[model samples]
Target: MSEVAMKPEIRVLETADADTFWKLRLRGLKEDPEAFGASLADSVDATHEEICKRLACTDDSFALGAFNPEPCGMLGFYRRQGERVRHKGSIWGVYVAPEARGTGLARRLMVEAIERAKKMPGLEEVLLTVSTTQGPAMKLYESLGFKEYGHEVKALKQGDLYIDEKAMMLRLHD
Candidate 1:
């Protein structure tokens, strides 16, 4: 196996990271709409305050950022906040800049996110949705022990094109 250079420094993002995180996230949504649900056009008007407010949430929900000096990629875990559903969390918004794709930054961020999720109180499984268009991401999740539970046809529609999404989950413990 070939070695990956550019040691990735991954950390859980706080409110202070909203600006950089927003920029990177907007780029991801704009560049690859099929991979994400949020569209740049819809979220562009959000004030910095709104952005910071969302990031300031220091609860079970968290956004993890990977920086190889600069912001390279991000992954997030959104905990289900119901009395009965709190045992599960959903992972979303996995993004790595095109320039950073081959460097294993995405994998590093994902592994760290999973590690954090396992440590989260009451969290037993982590779920994620990936469109069929995201083959690499799907394969990466599969390699990391996530199993597909179902597929949703026409899960997303952009203009006239419909996309199918696969729902996958990883059990943190037996």
Candidate 2:
């Protein structure tokens, strides 16, 4: 079977997968700096132990990995912690490698994340931000039922480039 024809194994990444997750995350940050809120430099000093802590799955937070026998795509979801905001969650660090872009891997990861979010006890809505430069990603989120609620001008400044970001949200229930 052709590699592209095979379904990727998507699962919640755990502590042991931290190293793999970190490498892919760095690539994502570096390869598409404007698409993410964090830069490669901000993450380079993060230790393996810190990544393991982040990957430790909890009822309200976890990271998903799409593996074609190795991590290729990643997305993070975490519910708000404070009492007033606990009903909301945010999706972060969404990335799919160049090789995986057209294979529907990103959509699969998103569907899985939304499904998981729906199961959380107090999760009423999920939110994420996308740079205006990411039109394809914005379209994918829209197709998945996310609505743009706001726009931030110059949300991120990378060198001389200023990225505007759209904030989008998906409500799980009425």
Candidate 3:
């Protein structure tokens, strides 16, 4: 197949996409357990019903997926709930299938997420956490104008190793 043919098309995920979203998310957690707080093994016990509820919630949260005619990767973001923190949002659960990596799908997903975030009323900035081991991801975030604001020690643990994560932010001007 050609390069473009192999690349997945990016789109906003809908409520009816619970199973596909869950499967892609679990795959990401399995491939990079340290990249996120959730573990694939732990989520394996979660039912599609739970996922459907999450996806259907109409709030300051949203998910986007990339599909090769089938869901292959996904990203999610949510705004803080408290009135004091409502202006800020956090990005999480960013993952692409192993087969979809290095094809610019992740960047496309990020762009879509960022665009959606900017449209949110009263939003000030978007933040994300990335492990030090995720060098490529860090570079991608930086290229998109995200700056390192701080770091958390032992933010994640896998096996006996503790991984530190860098907190990055991108400010949106009103």
- Which number leads on TM-score? 2
TM-score (C-alpha) between model 2 and the true structure: 0.96
- lDDT for model 3, on a 0 to 1 scale? 0.85
| Candidate 3 structure, TM-score to reference | 0.91
TM-scores, all candidates, are: 0.93, 0.96, 0.91
Output the better candidate (1/2) by TM-score. 2
Worst 10 residues of 3 by lDDT: 50-59
Better of 1 and 3 by TM-score: 1
Residue pairs that clash (backbone atoms under 3 angstroms), model 1: none
| Clash-forming residue pairs, model 2 | none
lDDT of each structure?
0.87, 0.93, 0.85
The digit string of per-residue lDDT tens for model 1 on 1-174 reads 234554767888888889999899889988999998777888878899988765554668888888877888988888889799999998888999998897777888889888888988889999999999999999899999999999999999899999999999999997
Q: Candidate 1: where is the Cα deviation over 4 Å? A: 1-5
Candidate that beats the other on TM-score, 2 or 3, i.e. the better one: 2
Candidate 2: 10-residue stretch with minimal lDDT: 47-56
For candidate 1, report its TM-score.
0.93
